[model samples]
Target: MDKNQLGVQYMQEGNWEEAAKAFNDAIEENPKDPVAYINFGNVLSAVDDDEKAVKFYQKAIEIDEHAGAAYYSIGNVFFTQDRFTEAKKMFETAMKKGLESSDNFFMLGLTLVQLNQGKLALPYLQRSVELNEHDAEARFQYGLCLAQLELIDEAILQLEKCIELDPDHSDAFYNLGVSFAFKETSVKAIEMFNKALEIQPDHLLAGHAKKLIENNL
Candidate 1:
């Protein structure tokens, strides 16, 4: 089998060292192979070698200026470093270069939220939810963005959807409670918090929500 295929299999098997070696061998055999560089970079990133991973990603981009995976990888590295602006730029560039995936939109939205640009993040978060409506995390994040925009009704709807998709999603329940709390519906908030605690007995947010409900009562 080709080294690229071997590298992919190793990566899938969680054999990071073997995956890196296979990709490196592929790179040695064909220095211009952007896939090899990208795979190598992924393995390095998996091993927490962000510095080397960045170089490999750069090399992949140099070989193929439109390497969306390379751009995404670099964006992930930047995100890990808390450089949200740079990460957002890289993710946007990847999307512009035709790297349109739910993950792309989700990461972009998450970065925008972290940067306190929830208004700007809203569309992307909404897109992520549209792409995967059953994605509990995406729906939960969409609720957060909507709440930030003071669209309380829409936020509650999204949070309800998240809870429906994954009944065990404690965070969704907790957030839904918060939305109810915002609307000054302490009874509903308490009910949601109770549901969250039922799902995750040790849920910290659920405990906090319970306290708030008691105070309001």
Candidate 2:
């Protein structure tokens, strides 16, 4: 069998080390094979060597400037390292190069939120929600962005949708409680806190919300 075929066989069998070695050999045999670099990078990423993986991904992009997967992979490595600015730049580059996955947009939105640029994150988050409205985390984060913009009612609706989609999401319940608290609806806030506690018995925010409710009551 060819080196590429053998490398793929090893990769499918979960022999990542062997897969990396085989793919590396394939690259050595054909220096211009972008797929070999990309496959090797994937193995490195799976093995948690993100720094090396980024270099291999970069090599793939150098071979093909429009390699959206390469750009996305590099962005993921930067994000894992908490280099939000670099990650954002790389994600933008990937998008500009026609990366159209919902996950890509979702990651971009999440990074923007982490940087406290929720307004800038809105369009990406909105696109993600439009693609999959039942994504609980996406809905919850969209609500958070809305709340940050002082769109209280819309935020509450989004949080409510999150809870509806995943009834066991303690964070969604907790955030909904916070939204109610912001509106001075102590009763509703208490209810949401109770729901959160039901889902996550050890949730710190739920316990704190309970205390606040009692104090206000």
Candidate 3:
């Protein structure tokens, strides 16, 4: 239909060149359209050109100061580049600008986790899980942050929820095993380790833990 819609279609099809052309046309038609700039940024981000993508996203913000997606896009680039502090600021700004995506909250929480502030990460990660309970990765990260805080029982719940959401999540099982071990529940810990190994036979850590548990260590 329109250049913006066409650009989105091309982007979904993984045709960066055509997507760029369509976005460029949209921008040429209306330089003030923040959405066009955001779409252009999406294409740049898809092609792993984060530096250029940041320019486009920043332009979108300049065009419309409240464009939350623009802020979120920049935050994603920062995250990819391991600029956790900057990414946290961008993500927080996105929320203040009214972007309510579960992934936005997840990324913000994960950034705090990266910054080694698990206590601060807790609320954001909890909100992420509340918004989208089916996201196993979010649950897993929340579980991990809980474990870092020595909230082992709460961590077990989150890890179990992660496993419930994704039965094949080897990390969830392995971590659950570790959590049980911390509670001195050796049999349950062994079971979880065994389950992890069953799902991933080459899980070295799980194998090691399972052996130790079986020997009553």
lDDT of 1 by residue, 27-140 (tens): 999999998999999999998999999999999999999999899889999999999999999999989989888888989999999999999999999998888877888998
Error of 3 at 124 (Å): 0.3
Candidate number achieving the greatest TM-score relative to the actual structure: 3
Q: How far is each candidate from the true structure, as Cα RMSD in Å?
A: 1.8, 3.2, 1.7
| Candidate 3 regions with alpha-carbon error over 4 angstroms | none
TM per candidate comes to 0.91, 0.84, 0.92
Q: Evaluate residue 66 in candidate 1 and report its C-alpha lDDT on the 0 to 100 scale.
A: 94
RMSD of 2: 3.2
Candidate 3 residues 44-158, lDDT tens each? 9898998899999999999999999999999999999999999999999999999998999999999999999999999999999999989999999999999989999999999
Model 1's alpha-carbon lDDT is 0.91
Question: Alpha carbon lDDT of residue 21, candidate 2?
Answer: 88
lDDT winner, 1 or 2: 1
lDDT of candidate 1 at residue 186, scale 0 to 100: 88
TM-score, prediction 3: 0.92
lDDT digits (tens) for residues 1-217 of candidate 2 = 8777888899899999889889999999998887788889989988899989989998998898988878888888888889999999988888998988777788899889888898999999989899888799889888989888888899999999998898898988988888899898998999999999999999998899789788868
The C-alpha lDDT values of all candidates are 0.91, 0.88, 0.95
The segments of candidate 2 whose C-alpha lies over 4 angstroms from its true place after superposition are 1-36
Who is ahead in lDDT, 2 or 3?
A: 3
